[model samples]
Target: MPATYNTDGAEDPDLYAQLMTERYGPLRLILAERNRPAPPRQARANLTPDPRAAEHRHQLLEALNNRPQPDPEPAA
Candidate 1:
């Protein structure tokens, strides 16, 4: 919650400005810029596949999907 006035009980302009700014700053920006243009995203076309990443992904998938390799053949 936020305070409506300062400790002195008077309509402190600074306090009012702060509270208003905190509560309405984001909204003011949104309303002021209806179009709200967003930054363009760059394509990762040049990024190369990481062999280690692929290997780790494969290991993780196998760990999740495969059962404990059945205890090796009984010692007998």
Candidate 2:
């Protein structure tokens, strides 16, 4: 269970800010230019597949096929 603080009807601004900072972290302000637009992306005309893809697949299949099997459990 987490500990909680009771304000006990106290409405002090500094106390509220202190409790808030303790419960959360210090307040942060981020200033950004929302009106700015993002840069355009480049479009590729031709895309070529990797040449060694088939070789990698063959090696992975061979490793899986060559893997040792676990011994079967003895009859209970």
The candidate maximizing lDDT is: 1
Query: Per-residue lDDT tens digits of candidate 2, residues 1-76?
Result: 1133334566785697677767665444211233356688678754788799999999999999999999999999
**lDDT of every predicted structure (CA atoms):** 0.66, 0.65
lDDT of 2 at 23: 67
Task: Report the number of the highest-TM-score candidate.
Answer: 2
lDDT of 2 at 10: 66
Taking all chains together, each candidate's TM-score versus the true structure is 0.29, 0.34
Model 2 regions lying over 4 Å from their true place: 1-46
In angstroms, how far off is 19's CA in candidate 2?
A: 31
For residue 33, give model 1's deviation from the true position in Å: 6.5
Q: In model 1, how many backbone clashes occur? A: 0
- Name the TM-score of candidate 1: 0.29
Per-residue lDDT tens digits for candidate 1, residues 1-76, read: 2333233553777676677668667545645576677789786675777769988999999988886666678677
